[model samples]
Each structure stands twice: as structure tokens, then as C-alpha cells.
Target: MISTQLLFGQLLLGLINGSFYALMSLGLAVIFGMINVVNFAHGAQYMLGAFAAWLLLHYAGIGFWPALILVPALVGLIGMAIERTMLKRLYKVDHLYGLLLTFGLALIIEGGFTHVYGSSGQQYPVPAALAGGWNLGFMFLPIYRAFVVAASLMLCLGTWLVIEKTRLGAYLRAATENPALVQAFGVNVPVLMMLTYGGGVALAGLAGVLAAPIYQVNPLMGSNLVIIVFAVVVIGGLGSIMGAIVSGYVLGLCEGFAKVFYPEASNIVVFVIMAIVLLVRPSGLFGKGD
Candidate 1:
């Protein structure tokens, strides 16, 4: 029988990983839902955020606290620029064009960083304030890890609230359905599109910043996680925010239990679930029929 401590430990770790999945997949959902853009470069944007935090700390003496805010804003600007210059034009064309462009951008961004950074992972120290752990009777939990879970969950819920409850969100959904109609109403749909893409990219950057202290800061780190995040997005539904958030955490728990019962299958369990879900509902668990 598995020890309770070990079981809880893995569950905690899985929950941590799920935090990342929720953040990254939610960003994908926002971009896709708002503008119908695939944004394959999201992983690259995530890598950029981690790298930005590292660079700020190294060359500028800026720390995690400041980088937490500055990095997202900086990366979001880059995303907006890409949207204005490239993605905007592709909106009228088939979505394949946008996907190909973003895929190419991802390759270029990842390649550029690898060439410069030598493909080796660099360690990012956890902030001094959150550098320790708490020992519960059942399991030991790192303070930084706990902070990650709290912060990520708050951001996820906040994003959902802003997108689902606010007037701006309604405008966004309307633009998604009929941009020309919204534009005819004097909504400046182009600007909204730009901002929506920027917001999505900003969220990915924030996830990267949160991940820096836990994982190595590396060029390919984003690519490593992005595939699984994509799977999470698909399992949740193409553009369902709540779906992304819920599926990420649930799958994480599933992975945790799988490890105890069937260690060898833990790695493949998520994909297996994804396949089964797809077979049952091609549009995904929370997706709507057209």
C-alpha cells in the first residue's frame, strides 16, 4: 500500500503543475475565443517572460516582485505588436494562415534563444521571502509552491470574472461573433482585437514568471510544457475558460492518483484521458456544438 505522505506529496506536486496548465491553457482559450487565432507562439511568449525576469534580475538588479508586474506588461506589448503587424492581416484569411505564422514565430523565437543561451537551463532562486516550507502532519509544503497555487488560482478566477461578468467581456464576445457588426456600432473592433491578444499573451507571461523559481529558466521550457497545455485546452474545450481551469486541476489530481496505483502509466494517463474525452465528445468536455 502507498504511504499517505507519498500520496499527498504527489497530489500537491500535481496540483502545482495544474496551476501552470490552468494559466497557460486559459491564455490560449482567451486568444482563440476572442479572435479565432491559434497563437502557437504562446510558448515562446512564455519563455520570453521567464527570460525577461532572469535578465531583469541579472543586469538591472530588479527582483521577482517588480518583474512580476513589469514582465507581463513588457511581453504583452510584444504580443500587441505582433497582432498589429501580422495577426491583424491574417484575421480575414483562413485561420491556417495565422497558425502557420505563429508556428513560424515560435520556431524563430525558440531558435534565437537557444542560439544565445546555449540550450542549458539556468536556475532561478526562489525569492527570499518565500524560500522555505511548512511541515504539515501529512506532507511538507514549500512556501513558494503554496504561493504559486494561491496566486495562480486568484489570477485565473479574476480573469474569468473580468471576461464573464464585465461589460468589456460582453463587448469582447460580441466582437468574436461578429466583428463587423460590433465595428459598425463604433466599437473599434481592431483595437479590441489587439488588446485581447495582448491580454492573452500577458497571462502566459505571468505564468512563466510564476514558474521561474520552481523550474529552470530555459529557452525550451515553454515548448516542453506547451504541448501538455494544448492538450489541457483541448480536453477542456477550445475556448472554455472555466473548462481549462477545471480540467487542469482535475487532470493533475488524476495524475497524482495514477502514480500510486499505476506508476508506469502516470505519464500517459493525461493523453489517454484526452483521447477518451475526444472520442466521447469531439468538441471537447465543455465545448458547444455549432
Candidate 2:
């Protein structure tokens, strides 16, 4: 029998991990929804964000707060560059080719980082403002984790608003349905496409920054998490923003519970759930059949 205190603590941890999973998976869904690219390099891009933050703090004497803003901007700009120079060329090709290209890019990035940084992890300190915990009746919750949950949730809501409520959102939705038709209406679909991709990647970068304090900063960090995120996305639904967010958190909580009840199955629990979901609804809970 699980104690209420332990259950509550695990729920909090689950929500914390869910924030990252949801943020990353939502970004992936947005990118895939617009461009139909697999974006295999997303994990590498996320890792780059952490590395950027680490660099700014260590070499440039920049603080975490500044790096939090600057790193995502820098990484977003890099993503835009990649989309224009490399991704654009593959637009007319088979999606498999695009996936292959991104996979290769992921390899290149991981290899480059491994060459320079070696495989060992680096630490990032929690900012002074967030370096404490709130004591509840039965447990203490780290302030940074709470901050991460709040910030990530806000960003996710903001992204949803941008895609669903605003004029830009209208254009994006229209463009996704029929790029040629939207382009005929005097909108520059290509530019919007590039920006969307960059923004999605930038979100991943932001997740990395948020994660740096909790997890060791390393090349493998993003790659490892990305798989679980992919599973989350799959279980949620491809290209469904709301679904991605909901599924990420739900699955994260489930994983946390599994850890407490059947520790041995925790590792495979997510994948097992994904397989079951796939068997039941191949298009996923919120996905439209392609």
C-alpha cells in the first residue's frame, strides 16, 4: 500500500517530468503538422540549447536568467538557418529522405559534441531565486521544479494560443491546410514555414534550459529524453498539439506510479502503453488518419 505522502511526491515529480515531455512533444507536433518533417534533429537542438546556456554562464559570465533568453534566441536563429539551407531542399522529396537527413544531422551533432566535450556530464546551478523548497505537510518540493512546471505550462498555453486564437494562428492553420491557396492570398508560406520550424526548435531549446539544473548537461541528455518524448507524442497523437500536452503529463504520472508499484517495469511501462494505444487506435487518440 502506497502512503498518501509518497503518492503526492511522485505526482509532483511526474508533473515536473511531464512539463518537459509536453513542451518538447508539443514542439515536435507543431513542426510536423506544418511541414510533415520528422525533425529527428530536435533532440540535438535541445542539447545545443543547454550547451549554449552552459557556455554563456561559464565563459561569458552571463547568468542563468540572461542565458535562458539568449540561448533560445540563438538556437532558434540556427534552426531557421538550417530550415532555409537544408530542409527547404527536401520539401519535395520523400519524407523518408527527410527523416534520413535529420537522423544524419543528429548523428553529426552528437558526434561533434562528443568529440569536443567528451561524454561526461556537466552541472548547472539553480538560480538563487529558485534555490529552495516549499515544505508541505508531508513533503518538500523544490522551488526550481515548481518554477519549471509553471513556466512550461505557461509556454505551452502560449503556443496553443498562438496557433488557435490570433491572426498569425489563422494564417498558420490556413497554410497547413493548403499552402498554395494561402500563398495565393498574398501570404508568404515559405517564410512562415521557416519561422514555425525555428520556433518549434526554440521551444525544445527552452526545455533543455529548464532541464539543465535538474539533469546533468550532456550530449546524450536530449537524445535519451527525445525517445521518451516521441513515445509520448505517439501515444498522444501525431500533429495534435493539445493531445501531445495532455498525453505527456498523463503518461508521466503513470510512469511515476509504476516506479513506486513495480519498479522493474518502470522503464518499459511507457513503451508498453504506447504499443497498446497503437493497437487500439493507430492514428492515436487525437490524430486524424492520414
Candidate 3:
């Protein structure tokens, strides 16, 4: 029998992983909803954020706290520029073009990083303040992991509130439904699209920053993770914000439990769940049926 401590520990780790999944999926959902573009470069942007944080620490003598704030902003700016200069031109074209362009961009970014940094993973020290753990009789909980969970939940909830409960969110929703109509109402739909793209990539960047200490900073880090996130997005239902959030956590926990019971199948558990979900509900857990 698995000890309670062991079970709970895996569950906690699952929740932490879920947090990142939720964040990345949220960004994907946002981009798809607003710009009608699937951002294959999102994983690259996430890698950029991790690298940005590392660069800041090595060259500028900055640390995690500052990087948490600055890295996402920098990435978001890069995303905005990409949208304005390159992605903007493809809006009138098929979404496949957008996907191909971003996939190409991902290859370029990852190749460049691999050339410069090599394939080895770089260690990012946990912040001094979060370097310890809490012992709760049954289990030892890493303080940093706890922080990741709390911070991710807050960020996810804040984003949801902004999108669902605010005037700006109303405009965004309106624009998503019919950009031309929104434009006729005097909203700057084009700029909004750019910003929405920026925001989505920014979320990816933020997740990267959070993941740095937990996972080694490496160019290929985001590639496999992004694939899993895409599965999460699909399982949650494409373009369903709440579905993405809930499915991320649910699937993460499922993966965690799978690891405990059938260690060999852990890696494929999420994909299995995704397949089942697809079969049962083609529209996703949270998505509306066509």
C-alpha cells in the first residue's frame, strides 16, 4: 500500500505541473479565440523567458524576483512585434499559414538557442527565500512548489476575471465574435488583436519563469511540454478558457496517480486521457458542441 505521504506528494507534484499546463493552455486558448491563429511559437517564447531570466542573472546580477517581472514583459513585447510585423500579414490567409509560420519561427528560435547554449540543461538555483520545504508530519513539501501552485492559481484566476468580468474583456469578447462589427463600433480591433497575441505569449513567458528553477533551463524543454499542453488544450476543449484551466489540473492529477500505480505508463497517460476525451466529447470537456 502506498503511504499517505507518498500519495499526497505525487498529488502535489501533479498540481504543480498542472499549474504550468493551465497557464500555457490559457495562452493558447486566448490566441486562438482572438486572432484565429494557433501560436506554435508559444513554446519558443517560453524558452525565451527562461533564457531571459538566466541572462539577467548572469549578466545583469539580477535575480528571480526581478526576472519574474521583467522577463514576461520583454517576451510580451517580442510577441507583439512578431504579431505586428509578421503574423499580421497572414490574418487574411488560412490559419494553416499562421501555424506553419509560427512553427518555422519555433524551429529558428530553438536552433539558434541550441547553437549558442548547446543541448545541455542549465541549472537555475531556486530563490534563496524559497529554497526550503515544509514538513507536515506525513510529507515534506517544498516551499517553492507551494509558491508555484499558489501563484499559478492566482494568475489564472486573475486572468479569468479580467476576461470575463471587465469592460475590456467585453470588448475583447465582442471583437472575437465579430472584429469588423467591433471595429465599426470604434474599437481598435487590429491593435486589440496584437495585444491579445502579446498577452497570450506573455502568459507562456510567465510559465517559463516559474518553471526555471524546477526544470533545467534548456532549448528543448518547451517542445515536449508544449505538445502535452496542446493535448491539455484539446482535452479541455479548444477555445474554452474554463475548460483549459480545469482540464489541466485534472489531467495533471491523473498523470500523477498513474505514475504511482503504473510507473511505466506515466508518460503516455495524458495522451491516453486525451484520446478518451476526444472520443467521448469531440468538442472537449468545456467546449460547446457544434
Candidate 4:
């Protein structure tokens, strides 16, 4: 029989993993939905965020707290530059072109980092304030892990609210559906689209900051995780924010429970579920029907 403590520990770990998945896939959803970009470079951007944090710390003596705030903004600006310089030209063409462009960027970024840093990983220390854990009766809960879950949940909720309940969101949706009409109203649709892409890239950077302490900071880290994140995005619906958030957690829980029940299937459980979801409901659980 499985121990309750073991199950709870596994579940907690699953929740942590889910948090990352949700955050990463949420960025993918926003970019794809708002700008119609597949963003194959999202993983690379995530790696860049972590690397930026590491660089700021080791070189400039900046710490985690400041990096938490600065890295996203810095990376977001880089993304905005890319959108303005390159992505703008592809919007009117086939999506495959955008995908190809992003995928190429991902390869270049990853390769550049690999050449500089090699394939080995660097460790990001846990912040001093969140360096410990609480020992519950059942299991020890790490404070940083708990904070990660809470922060990610709040961010996801906040993003959903802003996208669904505000005038800015309405404008975004309207612009998506009819950019020419919005442009005619003096909305500057091009700038809006660029900012939206920047926002999406910022989300990925934030996730990287959150993940640096938990995972190794390496050139290939994003490349390793992005496939799973992409699966999460696909299972959740391509552009559905809620779908990404909910599917991420559900799949995490599924993987956790699978580990306890059938260790052999833990890795494949998520992919299996993704396949089933795709087969049953291609639009995803929270996505709108065509």
C-alpha cells in the first residue's frame, strides 16, 4: 500500500511542476491568441530570462528579488524589438513562416548559449527569506515552492481578469477580430499587437525567474521543457487562457497520481491524456467551438 505521506509529497511536487507548466503555456496561449504567432522561441526566451538573472547576479551583484522584477521587463523589451523588426513582416503571410522564423531563433539562441556556457547547468540559490520549509504532520513543505504556486495562481488569475473583464481586453479582442476597423478608430493596432507580444514574452520570463531556483539554469533547460509545455498548450486549447491554466494543473495531478499507482506510466501519462483530449475534443476543454 502507498503511504499517505508519499502520496502527498508526490502531489505537492506535481503541483509545483504544474505551476511551471501553467505559467509557460499561458505565455504561449497569449502570444498565439493575440498575435497569431506560434512562438517556437518561447523556450529560448525562458532560458534567456534565467540567464539574465544569473548574469545580473554574478556580474552586477543584483539579487533574486530585483531580478524577479527586472528580468521580465528586460526580456519583454527584447521580444518587442523582435516583433517590431521581424515578426511584423510575417503577420500577413502563412503561419508556418512565423513558426519557422521563431524555431530558427530558438535554435540560434540555444546554440549561442551552449557555445558560451557549455551544456552544463548553473545553480541559482534560493532567496534568503524563502530558504526553508515547514514540516507539516504529513510532510515537509518548502516555502519557496508554496510561494511559487501562490504567485503563479495569482498571476494567471490576474491575466484572465485583465483579458476578460477590462476595456483593454475588449480592445485587444476587437483588434484581433478586426484590426482594420480598430485601426480606423485610431487605436494604433500595430503598436497594440507588438505590446501584446511583449507581454506574452514577459510571462515566459517570469516563469523562468520562478523556475531558476528549482531547476538548473542552462541553455537547454527551456528546450527540454518547452515540448511538454507545448503539449499542455495544445491539450488546453491553442488560445484559451483558462484552458492552459486548468489543463496544466489537471495533467500535473494526473502525473502525480500515476506515479503512486503505476510508476512506469508516470512519464507517458501526460502525453496519453493529451492524445485522448485531442481525439475527443480538439478545441480543448475550455476552448470555444467553431
Candidate 5:
């Protein structure tokens, strides 16, 4: 029998990993819902977020707390610029074009960072305030990991509420359904698109910032993780906000269990689940099929 400590500890680790999966996949879902674009560059933007935090620390003497707020904003602004300048041009074309464009952009960003930073991983220290752990009798829980889980849950829930309940969310939904009609109703559909894309990119950046302390701040960090996030999105359903959130955590826990029982299979467990889900429900667990 697995000890309670081992079980709980792995589950905690899974939850931490799931937090990032949920955030990144949520951003993917939002962008796809609003723009019908697969943002392959999302991972690179996540890398940028970590690097942004690193730069602020080394150059400007900024700390983690401030970087948490500023990095996302800066990355969102960059996302807005990219959407306005490059991605907007591909809207009328085939969706494949957008995918290719973003994929190319990802390669460019990763390559550029590699040229500058090499392929090495940089370390980001945990905040002094959250450097400790709690002994819960069954297992010890790191405060930083707990913080990540709590913060991610709040962020995901807040995003869900904004998209599902708010007036701006109503407008976004209306625009998605009929941009022409929404524009006819005096809504600036173009600007809405820009904001939506920026918002999605910002979520990725936020995830990157949260991740910097746990993982090495490396250029390929996002590249390695993004594929799993995409799988999580697919398993949850594309364009599904809640689906992304749920599937991320579920699959993360599943992976964690696999790690305990069958360590060799842990890495492939998520993909295996993805394959099973596709076979059972191609549209995803929470996705609405067309």
C-alpha cells in the first residue's frame, strides 16, 4: 500500500503542475474562442514572462511581487502589438495560415532567446515570505506550492466569472458569434479582438511568472510544456473555458498517481489519457461538438 505521505505529496506536486496547465490551457481556450486562432506562440510568450521577471530583477532591482504584476502587463502589451500588426492580417485567410504564422513566431522567439541566453536554464528564487513548508502530519506542504495552487484557482475562477457573467464578457461572446452584428451594434469588434488576444497572452505570461521560481527560467521551458498544455486543451475541448480548467487538474492528478505506481509511464500518462478521451469523445470532456 502506498503510504499516505507519498500519496499526498505526489498529489500536491500534481496540483502545482496542474495549476500551470490550467492557466496556459485557459488562455488557449480564450484565444481560440474569440479569434479562432491557434496561438502556437503562446509558449514563447510564457518564456518571455519568465525572462521579463529575470531582467527586472537583474537590471532594475525589482522583486518577485512587482514582477508578478508588471511582467504580464508588458507581455500583454507586446501581445496587443503582435495581434494588431501580424495576426490581424491573417484573419481573413485560412486558419492554417494563422497556425503557421504563430508557429513561425514561436520558432523566431525561441531562437532569438537561445542566441542571447544560450540554452541554459536560469534560477529564480522563491519569495522570502513563502519559503517555508507546513507539516500536515500526513505530508509536508511547501508554502510556495500551496500559494501557486490557491492563486491559480482564484485566477481561473475570476476569469470564468468575467467571461460568463460580466457585460464585457457578454459583448465578447456576442462578438464571437457575430462580429459583424456586434460591430453594427456600435461595438468595436476589432478592438475587442485585440483585447481578447492580449488577455489570453497575459494569462500565459502570468503562468510563466508563477513558474519561474519552481522551474528553471529557460527559453525551452515553455516549449517543453506547451505541448502538454495543448494536449490538455484538446482533452478538455478547444474553446472551452471550464473544460480547460477541469481537465488540467484531472490529468495532472492522473499523472501524479502514475508517477507513484509506475514511474516510467508518468511522462506518457497525459498523452495516453488524451488518446483515450479522443477515442471516447473527440470533442473533449467539456467541449461542445459542432
Candidate 6:
């Protein structure tokens, strides 16, 4: 039987993992909902973000704060380049083709990283500023983990607000519904689409940088988590930002509980929930019917 402390510890880890899952899925939703691409290469883009931060820190002595700011920008720029050069070509084609193209792109990215960085992983130490712990009556909480949780929450909330409330967000939502109509108002539909895609990719990259200190910086890291993220996205209902965030955390906690009572189930619990959600709501918890 697992001790209470261990259970809480696992729960904390689950929440941390969930936070990233939510962030990534939310980004995916934003991109797909507005830009109409499946973004199979999101995982690779995330890995690139972490790698970028690591390189900046190791070679240029950039610290966590700077890395946190700069890495996303770099990743976003790369995303824009990809969208402009490759993804834009598939806008009018069947989205399945876009998915296939991105899958191939993901493979190319992972393969390139593995060839250059090797199969071995690299470490990203938590900054001195965040290297500490807080004592709770039941268990000690790592300061860095707390920071991560807080940061993730704030970021998610900010994204939600932007999408639900601001003028730019209004334009984004309008564009998602009918780009041609929005463009008739003289709004540049293509540019907005590219920007949204870039922003979504940047979010993935930011998550990667945040995760590096907790998990090793490796080529396959994104691929490994991405499948599960898809499960989260499906369960939460694609194109529903709020649903993605809430479901990600709920499923993460569920998985954490499973680890205690039934270790074997921990691995598949998310999938089970996903399957159930699909059965009950074909459009997902947050998706709209065609």
C-alpha cells in the first residue's frame, strides 16, 4: 500500500504534468481551430524550444528568466517560417494531407536532433533562484515545482482571457469562423493565420523549456508525451481551450490516483477516460458538431 505522503507526492507530479499537458493541448486547439492544421509536429517544436533554451544557457550563459522569454520567441519565429514555407501550401488541400506532411516533418525533426544531439539526453538544472523546497505538514513541496504550477496556471489563464475577451481575440475568433468575411473588412487573413500558428508553436516551446529542468532534455521527449496529450485533447474536446485545461488536470489527477491503488492502470487510465468521453460525446466535451 502506498503511504499518504507518497500518494500526495505522486499527485503533485501529476498536477505538474497536467499543467504542461493543458498548455500544449490549448495551443494545439488554438492553432487547429483558427488555422485548420492538425500540427503533428507540435511535439518536435516543443522539443526544439527546450533545446533552444539549453543551448542559450549552456553556451551564452543565459539564465532561466531570459531563456523563458527568448526561447518562445525563437520557436515562434521558426513556426512562422514553417507555416509560410510549407504549411501554407496545404491550406486548400484535404487536412489529412496536412496531417501526413506534419507527421513527416516531425520525423525529420526528431531524426535530425537524434543525429546531431545523439540518443543520449541532456540535463537542465533548475536555476539557483528556484532551487529550494517548502515544508508542508504532510510533505515537502519543491519550490521550483510550485513555481511551475503557478506559472502554468497564470499562462493558461492569460491565454484564456485573450481568447475570450480582447479585441485581437475578437478578430481571431471572427477569423476562425470565416476568414473571407474578416478579410473583406481589410483584415489580413493569411497573416493572422500565420501569427496564430506561430503563437501556438511558441506555447509548445515554452512548455518544453519549463519541462527541461524536471525532465531530461531529449529528442523523443515530445513524441512520448504527445500521444498522451492527444488523448487529453480528445477527452477535453478539440477547439475548446477551457475544456482542454480542465480535462488535462482532471485526467492527470486521475492517473496519479491510479498509480497508488492500481499501478498497472496508471498507464492506461487516460486512454480509458478518453474512450469513454468519445462514446458519450462524439464531438468531445468542448467540440462542436458539424
How accurate locally, in lDDT, is each candidate? 0.93, 0.90, 0.91, 0.92, 0.94, 0.90
lDDT of 5 by residue, 67-114 (tens): 999999999999999999999999889999999999999999999999
Candidate 2 lDDT score relative to the true structure: 0.90
Candidates in order, TM-scores: namely 0.98, 0.97, 0.98, 0.98, 0.98, 0.98
Give the distance in Å from residue 38's predicted Cα in candidate 5 to where it truly belongs.
0.2
Write one digit per residue (lDDT tens) for candidate 3, span 52-101.
Answer: 99989988999999999999999999999999999999988999999999
Q: Identify the superior model by lDDT, candidate 4 or candidate 6.
A: 4
Give one digit per residue, the lDDT tens place, for model 6 in 30-58. 88877789999999998999899899999
Candidates 2 and 5 compared by TM-score, better number: 5
Best-fitting candidate, scored by lDDT: 5
In the predicted model 6, the residue pairs found to clash are none
Residue 16, model 1: Cα distance from true site in angstroms: 0.5
lDDT (Cα, tens digit) per residue for candidate 2, span 1-290:
88878888888888888899999999999998888888999999899999889888899899889988898899899999999999989988898988888889989998999999999999999999999999997888999999999999899999988988999989988998899999999999999999999999999899889989999999988899889989988988898889888988888888889877888997888899999999999988889883
Worst 10 residues of 1 by lDDT: 281-290
RMSD of each: 1.0, 1.1, 0.9, 0.9, 0.9, 1.1
> To one decimal, what is the Cα RMSD in angstroms of model 6 from the true structure?
1.1
Q: List model 4 lDDT by residue over 182-206, tens digit each.
A: 9999899999999999999999998
Q: Report how far off residue 148 is in candidate 4 (Å).
A: 0.4
Give the lDDT ranking, best first: 5, 1, 4, 3, 6, 2
User: Native-vs-model 1 lDDT?
Assistant: 0.93
Which residues of candidate 4, in runs, are more than 4 Å off? none
Model 3: residue 233 alpha-carbon error in angstroms: 0.4
Scored by lDDT, model 6 comes in at 0.90
